[model samples]
Target: MRLGPGMDYAVAEFPVPEPAPGQVLVEMAYASVCGSDVHLVDPDFHRPEMVGSPGYPGHEGVGRVVASRADGIEPGAVVLTVPSGRFGGCFAEYQALDAGSVIPLREGDDLPHVLMAQQLGCTIAALAKYWREGMRSAAVIGLGSAGQFFVQLLRARGVEVFASDVDAARIAFGREAGARAVHADELAATVAQAHPEGVDLVIEAAGLDATRALAIELVRVRGVVGNFGYPEFQVGTFPTMAAFRKAATVEWFSNAQGEPGQWCFHEALDAIRTGAIEVGHMTEVRMGLEDVPRALAITAAHGEGAAKITIAIRPESAIFEGS
Candidate 1:
């Protein structure tokens, strides 16, 4: 699938990528749309260079290693291949990924739902570096998949998470995930009335200017703000002066910041496997690669009724064999 500006997506048969040295050629079985993908498809973040690139914006996926030029991982291994590049090849039949970007999983790893681990790993990676002691209260702006994960992680640490989003369904998901959830329109007032001093930490997961600013505003003096989502531009202006005035600590990082060892991804997979993170409610998938455009449109609309919009590229409940 080739993506273009203004949500234009076309299905074109492109040549399958070849494995480079230390890379694996994966036969993609499932891929999911991410909040970042919606941002990339917008006219504001369009890149002409990627106009005709196949699978240019998808990064979350699960597949089987069809062949490998790398050691340790071999053919037939089922894995999660989530390349951290600006463009990804998971939307295609096969994507050639660096050996390190693929996390090997069990042959019986749940389909479609297991795909949720890609985003979970991202939240796990970013959160591991920012979470700390004495953070009693938090505000997560955006109850998307990433924001929901952040709320769960924070609540697990005994932090009172006040989560907000424009969508009603997601607000319910946040509440179900142990957050004191609210509608976006009610966030500021609700937070103000509940915590006059503001929350201890605020996570900006919506990546919009207003939400980013709200994260800073909702944090207490000397509190921390973690920017975890992809903004409209590669370069976005922050309320530096406001943060400075409050003596706040701003931690802005990417999900790929510590992806090399795959330890975070391993942790995420283990969590899912052990039922530490239940993804049963997140598995709503489109049938095939041809549905990429609609999936993107639905996700971009923000009322898709699915926590995650995934596309199953191939058939069969069992898509892999133990390597």
Candidate 2:
């Protein structure tokens, strides 16, 4: 599927991309829609930049390499292809990606759920920089998949986690992840009353600026606000009154910085593959490749009980569907 005008998505076939030197041609088995992909489709933040863009907005994918032009990497290898451009887009059935962009996966590993590592990597990369083993407490705003992952990861580190979301299902997921789940309406007051001094850190996973600002209000004096969510606006102002008053440190969790060695993604994949962390339960929704437009809409709309919406490109016989 390609991005059409006015935030529309329509299916169009493209030729199988040929691998250049140092590139690999992957026949995608599965791909997942991400929240950032939603920002790409929003008219307010879009401008047909990649017109006829082959997978212009998709990045999360797991597939098998059919051909390789790079040394050491071989054909028929199951890999996670994290493409950053049009040629390697995963929304299509095939992706021609740079050798460095593909990470090998164990053959028997469930490919679809492995897609979570792509998003997981983004979170852990930021956490690796700032997360301490025994912080006083942390608040994860926005109980989307990213927020839930933060709650799960933070709780494992022995920190108290307070989470919020408008969706009841996501709030429930946060509770299951061991967080003190609260509705959006009660988040600020709940955490404020509980901690009083504010949380040690705030993981603002919702892309809204309002949430970004709210992170400041919820964070402790001089606390960190790791901005993981993509802002939906092209150009917008942020409320800094809270941040200024709190002497807060706000940082955006950048995915590109995680690309140099791809160590973050590597670690995420290993954790998921080894059962060090569970991502299977997080991938709760599945749809066929043809439903990408609908899938994007569902993902863009935030949540209606959806967690990690997937586009299964291959036949049912190809993947071991989880229970």
Candidate 3:
């Protein structure tokens, strides 16, 4: 699927590329539609790489190394691929990526389970950077994929999480993930009732003007406000008067930081493998490659109870199992 400006997309059949030296050709099994992919289609939001130029617009997936011109990654190994750059994308039959960008999957790894490594890795990186010790509570606005994972991560670290979302299913999922879930309208009042001084940290995962403002409003004086969602348009005023009055620390994170071998991706992988993190509620929709354009449209509209939608590129039998 090729993505262009303003809801433009098409499925174009093309010959798969041969892997260059130090790279591997992967037969993509599953690819998750990211929030950024939805933003790239907005007419007003001009994504530099996607606007005007038609390119594949996906970054998270798992596949088998069909052909390896690399030293470390072996053929027949199931690996997680984080696609970036002009040529990198996984919403297709096959993808060629640098070996360093691919992480070998272990035996007993379920396809859907490992599909969350990149997304969870992103949350892990951000929380690791700003999550403070002795912080007892947090308010995570927007119980989407990132927010759902945030609730679990915070609770695992011994922080009480006050989660809110417009969707009832999401609120239920948040509660299942160990958060005190409430409706968006009741978030402030609920948090205030729990901690009169406000939560120690406020995470804006909804990526909307109201949610952003709510994050600032719900944080205690000198507390941290972490913006995890990427909105297509401008959200709230940056460092507004209210934020200034509270003197809250505002931090923004989009990419998953830290070394692949050390933090983030590795940490997320370990957590998922050990059952420390559960993503059953994250990928709310599942489709196939032929449904990519439709899936993008639904995700862009935030419709059909969709949070994280995954494209099953190949049949399960075709996906190589680590043997």
Candidate 4:
């Protein structure tokens, strides 16, 4: 399915692409609908620049290279792909991608798990620069997939994580991830009473004005606020005076900087491989390629008890064993 000329999309058929020199044709096994993908499809959040865009809608995918004209990548090798403006995207049955954009997966990697690595990689990249040592506590707003991932990542680094979300299912997932889960309405006061000086870090993953504002207010003086969620439109006139008074460092994050070679992927893979970050929870929602329209709609509404919903482009047997 392709993104809209407006707030609409339709399934269109195309001939299977043949690999060009230095490119590989991949048969997609699993592709994930990320939070950003959800927002990008909504009219309230859609960008005019992307109206009538021709590329597919996804970036997180795991698949087998069915044909390769590239040297390093061989036929049947499992690989990863990301969203690229020049190369298009992966929300389809097949994609022919640049060899450089495809990262070979390890032996016995699960398709869905590898896809989880793609989203986790973005979080890892942000933390690489902003997360500091000696930060003992953090509050993650929006206990969705990203928030749950942040909880595990922070805990691995020995930071106490407090999380909040309006969704009960997500709140439960946060608790299972070992975060002290709370309702969004109670987040600020809960953290204030518990830490007094406030948390050392506040991660805004909800992508709402109220939650973003709460993140800023919940951070201690000189603490960091990592804005991981993207709102539908620009948020004009921020509460800068409050942030200023607290001397906060508010950093907006995006995973677009690094591609296949980023250390973030390696770190996330290691965490996954070691079972330090559990991805089983993320695989709760699954569908087939034919269900793309409904999946996109559900994800955009932030409903359907979603975490990381995966589309099975191929049978489960197609997933590599022992991942």
Candidate 5:
């Protein structure tokens, strides 16, 4: 399929390849639509490609290792593979993965299933970057999949968390995910009332310009503001002077850096497996590969109804028929 501008996807037949040394072939079972995928689909964020060359785009995918040149990852092993920006092809039925980048999934492992690994990893990395000792209050702006995950992480760490979103449905979802849900318009007042001295941490997962500024304003002195959302191709202005004066640390997290080199995936997996984070609410939508294009559009246009949209690639008969 071609992820070209104005063309969300176009089917093309191709031959399946064998895994090379130290690599594995994953028959993808599920792939989640990330905020970055939406950005890539925007014309403003468009990048030129080399003539006649194909670029595969996808990072968050879960599947079973159907074939491998490595030892422990033999056939039928469920795993999560980290494909680099250019050659990472998770949107397809079969994805070639480097052995080192694959994390094995045990049989009946509820924690590391297709629905949990990718988002959990990203959330864990963001939390690790901004979490602090003695921090007791947090506000998560934007209750998308990431924001919901942040709410769970904060609450798990014993912090009082409030979640805000323009969409009421999203706010309700946040509440179900264990956050004190509030609307965007009421966020400033909510934070002010909850913390009085300002919240200890403000996680800007909304990617809106207004929310970005609010994150800076709502954070307490010496508090941390972590920006984890991928806003559309646009720059946002914030109260830099106030943030500086308050000694607030504004950190921008990109999952682009979290593949194999960084422990983003592993950290998220550990958090999910240990119950330090919750993924049940995040997997709100499930569809098959045929729904990829529409799923992307729905996520891009109206993200209020979903936390995470999982794309199932394998049939139930193939994975657990006889068992």
Candidate 6:
């Protein structure tokens, strides 16, 4: 597919890829649309150099191994794989992946739907970084796919979670996912009334500059604020002074290059397997590759009513089939 300034996506036939040494060829089963994908499509952020040789733009995909160089993962095994860079190729029918990037799906575990695992991993990493010892109360700003996961994860961890979003439908979805939902404008007061000391941890998953400032405002003094959202535009004014005076810690979480270990991905998958966290509700809309452009448009324009919109690559298969 080619993504340009005035263009959306144009699918074209290409030669099937063959795995090289230490790589695996995956037959993609499902791929989820992410907020960052919307940013990449924006003309302002799109860079000619960032586009790959084959020019595929997907990072979150679950697939079945068609061929592999590794010994443990069988050819028939299902797995989740992410591209090493921005040009990572998950949007295609077949993708070549390094063995290290492939996450093996256990027998009887869901395979086709590993997007949940990928998303859950990101959320768990953020929570693990900022969840505090004295965190009796928590709040998550934004109820997108990741935000919804954050809400469920926090509540599952025994924290009383308060979720806020500009979209009312998302707020309701948060409530359904076990969070006490409130509007973004009303979040501060609502949380203040519920916990005078304020929430101990506030997670900014909305990926908007304004929400970053709101997170700093809602957190208690000496508390922690975890930022899991990737804002498309540069952040103008963060509440630096308030954060400093309150002795708060601001942590940024990204599954991309900055991290050294793959601990978060493993931890997230395990949590889902054990039922410690649930990601079922996040997959609100499921479409095929042909519907990707429309799905992306909906996610970018409509912030609520839909959480995680996944593209089903394998016919008659769930995103996570074995699991």
Which portions of model 6 miss their true places by more than 4 Å? 1-7, 52-55, 256-261, 316-323
* Best-performing candidate as measured by lDDT: 1
* Rank by TM-score (best first): 1, 2, 3, 4, 6, 5
Error of 6 at 101 (Å): 1.0
Instruction: Output the lDDT of residue 249, model 6.
Output: 88
The better-scoring model by lDDT among 1 and 6 is: 1
lDDT of 2 at 97: 84
Q: Provide the overall lDDT of each model, using Cα atoms, as 2-decimal numbers.
A: 0.81, 0.78, 0.79, 0.77, 0.72, 0.75
Candidate 4 lDDT (Cα, whole model)? Answer: 0.77
lDDT of 1 by residue, 222-280 (tens): 99888887775766677889989999988987757256676777778888888877677
Q: What is the lDDT, from 0 to 100, of the residue 96 in candidate 2?
A: 82
Error of 4 at 106 (Å): 2.3
| TM-score: model 3 vs. ground truth | 0.90
RMSD to truth, every model: 2.4, 3.1, 2.8, 3.1, 3.4, 3.3
Tens-digit per-residue lDDT, 203-273, candidate 4? 98988777778888899999999988576455444678999999999998775435446667767777787
Candidate 2 to truth, TM: 0.92
Report the candidate with higher lDDT, 3 versus 5: 3
Local accuracy of candidate 2 as per-residue lDDT tens digits, 153-267: 8988889899998888888889988999989989999997899999989998888877887888888998888988566566767777768888888887665424669988888
- Candidate 4 residue pairs that clash: none
Query: Is 3 or 4 the stronger prediction by lDDT?
Result: 3
